[model samples]
Every structure is written in C-alpha cells, then in structure tokens.
Target: LALRSLAFQMSPQELDLGPEKVPGPVWGALFETHDAGAPFSLLVLHDGTAHLYLSTGGGLIGSHGLSEVSQASQRFMTQANRLHHQARPSQDHPLPAAGMSSFYFLTYQGVLCYTAPEARLGDGHDQLSPLFHLARGVVAALESAHHHQSRHTPPAR
Candidate 1:
C-alpha cells in the first residue's frame, strides 16, 4: 500500500495487528516527511510496532518491533492523545511539500491530521513541536537499535 494512502485506508484495528500488542484501545499514528528524495513515512502502533515506508516502493520497506515501548514513544502517544482536539478531522491526507512534515493520528473516532514545516518543528516554534520531537526521538531509538542489530548479525554467504 502507498504510504500516503495509509491515512485514508488504514484503521486503528488494522494497525493493532502485530507481534506485540498493547492491552488497551487500539490506536496508531503516522508521520510523513517530504524531502528532496523519496518521501518517508513512519507508522507507529500503540503496541510499539513501527513500520517505515518509502514512496519509491509505495509499500512497507522496514519494520522495527520494540520489546517494550520507550519513554519517548509513550510520551509521544500521550501527547498525541491530548492534542487530538487541536487537529482537524481530515479525510484528505495531503502530502506535504518538501521540507515539510505531516502527522496523522488514528483513533476510534476517526483520522485527525496537521502539517508543519520541519524547521519550525525542530525549532520548537510549532504547536506540534512536542509531539514532533518525541516522534523523532523514537525514530532515533529505532535507528540505534537497527544499527546495533546489524553489527551483531553475521554476514550472509
């Protein structure tokens, strides 16, 4: 499935179907970053399963499963829940322009979304800065874990 289509197609229940399961109401989030190269999307479930998709393939490219949710990821979810009121209910999941990022929250109610420039988010000038940074931190943790795993895995013949 196309990463952008996820906002319109994926449901919270579908996102909850992973190896790990969070015992509570199913919820999920999607973060899309548009840059000079292929757009990137990070889809995170309450279960701490994250799938990273690239526009080049229009499908899932990588997935990282967390044995336990990191503090930043948990905080990100909490902040997202609290800020849902600020996001407008969206049926159109528009792709942000280059250097911009779009965030989507999938709850029981429906899909909510907002977009902001990466610069503003990084500089803490955007209202969604807190959630943005927390998501970034989660991404960093995933990258670090992937790096560590690669180093330990034996090379294939």
Candidate 2:
C-alpha cells in the first residue's frame, strides 16, 4: 500500500448525494427501490480523489475490495444492529454521530475507513487534515489544483 501524508487544501465539487446514483452496470443494482431510501450510498470522484456518502437510517458499509469489504461490513453491520437495539425515540440525536448510529466504512485510496455522520462531524474548518487523511489522495489532488493557474473549483456552501 502507498502511504502518503495528506496535506494542503483546495476547494472541491460538492457531492450529490441525491439518491442511489452510483454509475456502471455492475454498480447500478446497488440501488434497489427504497420506499424511504434507508440503505444507500453516494460515490463521488474528482480527478484522482474520491469519497463516498452513505445514506441510511442504519447503514454501515464499505468497499475495500470485495473480500475485505465483505469481512468489514459484517462487523460494521453488527455494530449498527446493536445500536438499533438500543434506540429510543427522542429529539436528542435521533442518530449517533460516531462509533455507532449511522456510520460508513469506506476505503478511499485503499485506506480502510469508518466515518461518523457528516452532519454531526462538526464543521469542516478544523477537519481538513482528518478529511484529507480519510481520503488519502484528496489533499494532494486538491493542493495540485490550488497551485494551478486555471480555474479552481469553488468550495461548498
């Protein structure tokens, strides 16, 4: 595995997590009809960088090669199931932000990841390093873009 330090920051295109919109024939079926769209994911790629957005009331998923992904998903799902068991209706944190509740296990540039909810991950201001670390190639890619004399992508609002 290529170990690279994630540094530098550049604006990126926003991830369109509208629905189960993964591309390619093999990946298309990942989108099954969901009355409420409980378990789904969004895969966004720009240049050589990539990130995945999981949309599930209780989904914990990963795709780090099929075999490793399969192994990881079972453990992640087990944790999700445990959280489901302890769930109670309340206005406070309808979903947990980390460790449990709705989390995603993604391998960005081969780095195995378990992510907490985006909404509760706090603002991205203090998150550049961690975010780049999570998606190993992002910092380098973004930094390259930052150095370019051409148009740079705008940051998300």
Candidate 3:
C-alpha cells in the first residue's frame, strides 16, 4: 500500500462529491490533515458512511450504525453545519500543504472550504477545532473496529 498508489482515493472528487453535485443543506464533510509527512483524510457523510484514507496506504470504508463511529460522525456533522456559514465557497479542490489542514463541507448550495495551520486546529485555537476533534474520534472508532476485526478473523491461507 504505497502512498502514491492511494493518492486518487484522497480527494473530494474521487469520493463522488463536488460543489456542482451536492444540493440543499450541509450533508457531509471531508477533513484533511497535511502536516504528517503524508496527507490523511476522513470523509464523513450524514448517513453514517465514513471513509478514512491513511498516509500509509489502503483505507477503511464502513457504514456506522449504532456504533461509536456513528456517534462521532453525527457530532462532527452537527458542528460542521453550524460552522459552514463561516466557510467560503470553494472554487477549486486543493490539498493543503504541510503544516496545514483543510475542511470541505458539502452543502446544497455548494462546497465550502476552510483551511488553517494544523497546530491551530489541533490546539483548539480555531473555531473549527471542535470539528477537528470530533473527526479524530471518528478515526479512533474506525481504527478500533479494524483492530477488533483483524484480531478475530482467521489469517489468509
């Protein structure tokens, strides 16, 4: 799972989402952190469909039901919608540079974007810090589920 091989999976367009396609209110968010040598992304939709693309390659795609992932996804969306107005309409889909983070909100009107230094977002110094924290929770829950599944499943022959 080389990082380059998974590059296509890390963008908003690859997820079948864009400003022109989505309509109405905020329905989902794509949060990306770029300071960690390689980019990492979390795409969380209103229906509890979450996909995490790691810098190490490969990724996780799941529909969370009554799990912790679902709860975290819900909370992330709530804050995303509440803060969407503060984001500007995105003219292009661009990945953040190192030491930065980007948040793209899919709304009925169109996609909106907010970008800031990773430290600012992670340290609760930005207004969107809560969303960043909630996204982390979703990532944690996804990782937990993956770990549990791996431990219980039989190895490939």
Largest lDDT belongs to which candidate?
A: 3
Q: What is candidate 3's lDDT per residue for 47-155, written digit by digit as tens?
A: 5667787767667866456377787787888888788887899867677889988888877656789999889989999998888888888888888887887899998
Q: Which stretches in model 2 have alpha-carbon errors above 4 Å? A: 1-51, 54-65, 89-157
Clashes of 3: 2
Question: What's every prediction's RMSD, in angstroms?
Answer: 3.8, 16.8, 4.7
Task: Rank candidates, TM-score, best first.
Answer: 3, 1, 2
The lDDT per prediction is 0.69, 0.26, 0.75
Write one digit per residue (lDDT tens) for candidate 2, span 1-157. 0011110111121333222442211111011111233433322232112323334332222233333333333333333323322222222212232322222222111112233434333334322223322332322233333345135556669
Q: Which regions in candidate 3 have their CA more than 4 angstroms from the true location?
A: 1-24
lDDT of model 3 at residue 69?
76
Tell me the TM-score of each prediction against the true structure.
0.79, 0.22, 0.80
Worst-scoring 10-residue span by lDDT in model 1: 17-26
TM-score head-to-head 1 vs 3, winner:
3
Instruction: Candidate 1: list runs displaced more than 4 Å.
Output: 1-8, 14-26, 35-37, 58-71
Residue 52's lDDT within candidate 2 is 31
lDDT of 2 at 85: 24
Tens digits of per-residue lDDT for model 1, 85-125: 66778887776678898888876767888888899998999
On a 0 to 100 scale, what is the lDDT of residue 151 in model 1? Answer: 98
